[model samples]
Target: MWFQNANSPIMEYLLFFHDVTFLLILIIAIAVFFFFELIFMPTDPHRFLIDNQSIEFIWTLTPCIVLLMLAIPSLQLLYLTDEAHGVLKSFKAIGHQWYWSYEWGQELIFDAYMTSIPYRLLDVDNRIKAEMAIPMSVYVSSTDVLHCWTIPVLGVKVDAVPGRLNQIFFSLNRPGIFFGQCSEICGSNHSFMPISLESMV
Candidate 1:
């Protein structure tokens, strides 16, 4: 079935191995956790016992084997995905207190500020044309305080730390204006720091 599927060799290996590894580790964890008892028993009944080290071996050995299986292929994939693979462009995004600055280069960059609008408000807002779709690459870092750049659907979120440059890489596989926010609390404007990305193509 894997060979029949049309995808790259590395992608195929990863897809198959990831599941196999997860199942193996999960089974190992279940075996260890259930070994001492059907589920988990406590050294002391007083503790609610949400966590236990009963399956230490299962957890340890399985992860090691999974990593070993993954490492060689992962490294190979990383090497193959290098710059020489294709012509990919880079963008830089800087995070301010309540807005995001995107830079393609010195000549081309834009500042996207979060506007407070109700669900129905989008219907009237012509400026909100990208309410769901604008093709762009977002790179985020901070100007001062710490902030978290999150977009759940794309599975790309990272923190913007001050003084140090923190970067998160993502492309809009889905073209739409996605919602995000500053997860970390910073100053009086923390609650006001709403984030939204307008995906376009």
Candidate 2:
């Protein structure tokens, strides 16, 4: 619920910065594209009010600036992966066709967790926790076709490509269960590739 609970003092600042640097740029870009595509778009109208060359230059430079804003912090975040670690614990999440495999690693204890989604997932009975039991710091990936392991609350998303190990390191800042899914298109049961996390204190 990190996206939903941006009401605190510290998180509000982080959310503001996140929006200024990411969401705003995306909104602006999409609005510009929509404007070009749908709105005030005269019948074969000329761009830049004059020449095609000017319109081309404007579009080119605008995206360059927007993407530069996007990439600068994006690369910074990727390069400095562990700077935000609350503690030193780690977990591993491995992706299969219809479910996710979780490996929880502690200095003293390690447990393997396996779980799947519940029926009527949209209208569940208990919203307090997840149907699966994935522990924190569970590094997750795929075993076959390409998929993506994403936990938005943890601010972590990585591709689950086959034959390759992609890792994400996150400890549970909060003690509860988290849920995610296979964010990439793979096969017939791709939508069933759900992920879960149970944060232990």
Candidate 3:
């Protein structure tokens, strides 16, 4: 319930997977508790005296099936997040010690610093603007220490390593402003390095 509303296809898939896995876990826990109660009843003194091979086999196979169900979809989502083909727009996000800089091509570049005005720490001096319904690629790197660029609503997070470049792909489904912060602890002002993105049609 605390999760932010999903604004992209990947985020929707992530939310669906989370709900399905949670339901599976709840069902397994309840079933296990029920079996424990039935097996350990005080009135059934001979409960441990009998064993059924069929029941043993069913329990063993059930867990393996459950594991497969969880694994297959998880692997698919992982692959989906990494696929960056046919990206219409590409940009670079360079993280600094306490701020973020963006390059939208050779012609446009700017630094986004934290502001204390309307949105308080969540607001920035400049926001990244882009169109919706277009596949976009973002290359992330760090200029100083380690940092992470993240946007939860879009389900995009990539580490900004000092010497290496990491990339993430996503398409926004709606027009709105999304906020995220540096997930990695880099310095004393780590919390002040906020990320703001404004999506449009």
Best by lDDT: 3
Expressed as tens digits, the lDDT of each residue in 1-201 for candidate 3 is 578999999999999999999999999999989878877787895455469777788879999999999999999999999998689999999999999999999999999999998898898999999899999999999989999999999999999999999999999999999999999999999999999999998
How displaced is residue 10 in candidate 2, in Å? 13
The TM-score values for the models, in the order shown, are 0.53, 0.54, 0.95
- Which portions of model 2 show Cα errors greater than 4 Å? 6-17, 22-71, 82-87, 105-119, 122-137
Predictions in order: lDDT? 0.55, 0.56, 0.94
* Model 1 lDDT tens row, 1-201: 222231233344445665676786787688667655743555554254346566566567877886787688667755543313222445666668766666776777776664546532121122212212223344567898787875554444568777766544343444555555677787777755555655555
Can you rank all candidates by TM-score, best first? 3, 2, 1
Regions more than 4 Å wrong, model 3: 45-49
lDDT of 2 by residue, 65-103 (tens): 877877786666556553434434555556666555555
Question: Of models 1 and 2, which has the larger lDDT?
Answer: 2
What pairs collide in candidate 2? 91-137, 91-138, 91-139, 92-138, 92-139, 93-138, 93-139, 93-140, 95-141, 134-198
- Root-mean-square deviation of candidate 1: 9.6
lDDT of 1: 0.55
